[model samples]
Target: MSVSIIKCNSYRECRAGIDKALSLIGGIEKFVHPGDKVVIKPNLVSKKRPDSAVTTNERFVHEVIKITEAAGGVVTIAESPGGPYSAVLLKSLYRTCGMERAAEGTAAALNYDTGFTEVSYHTGHTLKSMPIIDPVLEADVIINLPKLKTHAMTSYTGAVKNLFGVIPGTHKAELHFRLNDRAAFCSMLVDLCERVKPTLNIMDAIIGMEGDGPTSGMDRHIGLVLASASPYELDLAASAVIGYAPNEVPTVREAIKRGYSPKDAAKLDVMGESIEKVRIPDFVKPESHFNLLKLIDLPPALNALVVEKLASRPKIEYDKCVSCGECARCCPPEAISMASGRPVIDKSKCIRCFCCQELCPKSAVRIKRSLLNRFMVNFLK
Candidate 1:
């Protein structure tokens, strides 16, 4: 399998970069045929603007839509962002993320249907059956448009993690509650990617997030656009660009273990700029993931004990908190509750999924690592 890694410095260069990337991988026509129902899934994780690099760049997605439409495919932009999925939320997200402007003069339509249907994936290692968004279920072809970012829970967010948006509203939290183990959660992500199997994978890396992300992070210009037929390979290449080894990302590690991707990214057929040329060696990873727990080869039970102390936990920034109760409402394990207009977290019940941190609108939730863990991490480095 081949992945196209075109160097695109700005959103204005998206059309050309995306077109070239598509051509390098045998063109949009290879996946999109006339009259096909195409669903373009972009990561609108929150109500963040495109410049923040929290969500997929609208200009980048616009180019994908135009190319697919030019090939006579009916294009629709669909996404189930974190929190309760509804038409109102979707509308607000579309407007805030600049998707409305992207589709201003185009034939592409935005999906407002919050309805979902049950899908059975017998081959899934962690999940057997689940609900998927209606637009994705009805599509003849799925085109994944994901934003490259570091994640608090999953380490890296790209091709495979992006498909988590298809599971409808709060069902994502349900899965997080069920499979609290990091490996199992990531395995479920691989299963979701395998089930949906997007015909094309495109990533927005022109300006991506670093440090604690998917939502709260600093925007770093990586100046690259990536595309691939294989979601696993796409993630493998994208994660490597940002200084992550394949095994560092849970989803990529799972993919490699499942034989879906090459363990060594150097073995893949990479077109356009070399990974070495564009690689950011100093990319800041999520501080929440800086601990050395994963590197220690302890028994399962002991490992969990050590991780409980070392792993990062969510902390509410009371000064910045607006008492919105959003964190309480979205917590997977019901570990958070709003008491007297302030949300309090039940650490005993907390599963460390970071849904509160991820879905918090005010960025009031922060990852807090213990003093001992911090010292160990720094000393190891």
Candidate 2:
């Protein structure tokens, strides 16, 4: 399968760009059939404005809904946000992210269903099962719409990483706590891609997030809309465009190891814009992407010392905190707690998932790297 990369400088041209990209890959009609229950899975991670680059562009979603309608498919926008999952919270997030506005006049509707189904995803990996959001499981066609961004935890968040949202609510915490190691979590992610392979994967890279993202990052004008049948291939292109070695991303790395993706991406049938023409040389990656430890097979004693000595932990800023208890409520390891209207993070118990940081609306959760980690980070760079 080929990856289609089209230039869309702004959300104003999102429709045209999307149409051209889809047409090159046999059109939306090729996948979605009449009367199909289509699920549009966008990266609605939080209640942030589209310009913040925390979520997918609403205009793009509207345009896709229009295309799906023309193809005679019933489209429903579905995403389980990072914090507690509820109709009220989901509705608020939808409203803030302009998704509710997209759903207002369009045939597409926002998913309010909060139920989950325990899916047995036997991809021959450590993770054999996951609790998939009900709407995703019930849909006949899943159109993954991911936003290109840098993740503090995974280093890259693209098409494959985006599917992690399918594990609804606090159940995501279970995965994070259980598979605490980055490589293990990433293997589970790759296995997930194998299990719930979306019919199509489209990306919103018009304005991507960089420097500690998935949330709380600076906006980057990438000016591109991408599409592919394989999310893995699409992410390969995305990672390259943003100056990341494809293997640097856990999902891509694991996919390559599993023989699910080509190691030499030059083999991909690339169409539309050339990767050379759109590639950014100095795109900002997360500051604490010091995951080289995972590649080295250190002894148990050394591993413990390395993790304890160099690992970055979350620190709550009292002045910036709203005392909403979001960090405590969403922490995968139950590491944070609210005390006297302030959030206290237990570094000993913290698994460093950054779920608290990703979910913190105030951007109050900051990454506090050890002195050794800071020095080593600069040394490595």
Candidate 3:
């Protein structure tokens, strides 16, 4: 339950910096044993280059692979992205980040489909068992290499959120539709994390996205690399460094309640530098209300009605939208249509999963709140 925070000033020194950070928390050998099949899960959500800050840096992935090799473990890079999960996109992302050449020269194999093996989870609720992607379930160890970035849906996307890549691309939209509420989504994220428990968690924060992130956000220089054995602990440290509270992030709060180490920062022995040393300026929370139920308690049906009416997808600026159709393609429940010039969201059918907001390439879509909604949010804060 220890987290290590390091102030990494440049990607040029990422390999050495990350090595030092991992050394503080029992080192790579402690996690990846000899002859183990280590899966390096970097944030390859899209084909965007490293400079875009949309995906984990190639150099960071290479560094982790180097460490795994040094530990006598076989390394393989893998991920499942939304909207037509293709090996081509994954390979392209790696090449953009300068990983393709390294993979070939290092003789590291890349597993795309590794196909799928169905594993069941007994939830003890309406869902008796759910099938998860196979590569994650079969790997001897997983080194979660996630980029530090803001998420329009869950507030911040860190280690735990990055594990969502294991859910497989085709099934992700369905899961979003099923777990519509923020609390429910948080629960599902923790569930997935528990199922595919990574041996190590690493955050690539040398350059991170903010404002409207995960996909379409501006990059800011935040020179640091974070490592932890516990994903929850890593997320807690990440939230703090980003000027957010553990409770403010639904996934972190839920992980803590589920007996994960989100709080108890004192129990976490930070390694390279104090969090205050690498702390970034306060990041603005996306324009959305978090604690909706706290404002008023309504019956289940009434609450559903109110939330549905209140939550509407803000209009997409066609000029700004690059006709990528990513929003239309990823909309859960198939509520977005691009039959017109650009994508048009059907509010009545929309489930408000925020998949479009997270995947939009142009940063055209945002959560628009009316004057009353803004007033209520301000008053509540």
Candidate 4:
């Protein structure tokens, strides 16, 4: 597998940055042809501004659309918001990221409601058919433009995680509730990626999120754009730069096991800047009930039951929580309820999918880790 990287300085240079990155791997002409219906799926998880580093840089998306259109392809920008799947959010993202102006100027349309289609994947597991955004399914070529950000649940969100946007907002919560366990959830993510099978994957690493990420986190500049045909390979490369081992990341490991790509960096060819130069500081992984599963030795059946029973939904820090109800609204199982002007978690029904933590607008929800849990984690590490 080949992955290309270009050292970009700022958003103003995005067009040149994309040109340099793509040229290193073959050009837009190679991946997209004339009259092709190209869908550019950027990370528009929320309505956050570009500097927040929570979503893909609008400049990057604009550059991709510009290149595709110049190469004689019809381009359309689309995404399904994380929770509450609202056109309001989509419009807000476009406006805040300056994508609205870019789209209009480039003659590309912004689609919030493209409808849905059923796509089947032979996971050989329990899940058979999955619903995905119809525009993604029907597109002749999908240029996956994802933001390079750290995720509390997945360690890092790169090319592979971006595919999650393909699942319609209405069904995302259901999937989270169904695949509650980390391993199971990772399997579901891989299944979705397999069905979508993006033609090309590009990561906007010019500015990346760290600390409690994907949605809420601190913005740090990394100044790079990465591209590859294989999402798994791109993720592996990005994870290493963030000081994470490929095997330790559940989703990348699961993808490798499913015959996607080799998890080891030595097995793949990385083009462009040296990994040493692009590496960033390590990020903290979110707390999960599964961490306890590693400490105790129990039967698989009993272990599963224990995890289900002990898993906790996110707890709100009232002082920090704005009571925006973003956490309550995004709760996959609807386990979070606003009772007396504060968010409460229904532990019995919580799935520990971390969607609440991932989508919390205020970054108010944090995994309530006990002292024992902290000690165990330190000892294990």
Flag regions of model 2 displaced more than 4 Å: 291-300
Strongest candidate by TM-score: 1
Instruction: Please provide, for model 2 over 1-381, each residue's C-alpha lDDT reduced to its tens digit, 9 standing for 90 to 100.
Output: 889999999999899999998998889999899999999999988889877889999998889889988999999999997767799989898989999887767788889999998888665497778888999999999999999999989999988899998888788888899999888999888888787889999899999988878797788999999999889999888898898776688888888888777885666788998888888989988765776644268888787877678887788888898899988998888887787668888778988889988999999987777888887777766
Per-residue C-alpha lDDT of model 1 across residues 253-340, encoded as one tens digit per residue: 8999999989878988999998888899999898787645455688877877877778799999999999988898888889888877
lDDT per model, in order? 0.90, 0.87, 0.78, 0.78
**Least well predicted 10-residue stretch by lDDT in candidate 1:** 287-296
- Using alpha carbons, what is the TM-score of model 3? 0.91
Which lDDT value does model 2 have at 330? 89
Ranking by lDDT: 1, 2, 4, 3
The TM-scores, one per candidate, come to: 0.98, 0.95, 0.91, 0.91
Clashing pairs in 1: none
Among all windows of ten consecutive residues in candidate 4, which has the lowest summed lDDT?
Answer: 284-293
lDDT of 4: 0.78
**How would you encode candidate 4's per-residue C-alpha lDDT over 1-381 as one tens digit per residue?**
688878998889878888888887888888899999999999987777777888888778878988999998898888887765667766776898667866866978888774787767776353688988878887999999988877767767888888888898858888888887677878788878877889998889888877667776778777888988899988888877777777767778887887788757657677888777777755444354224536348887887665555553467788998888877887877888888778888887777677888877777887776565556567767
Best by lDDT: 1
At residue 177, what lDDT does model 1 achieve? Answer: 92
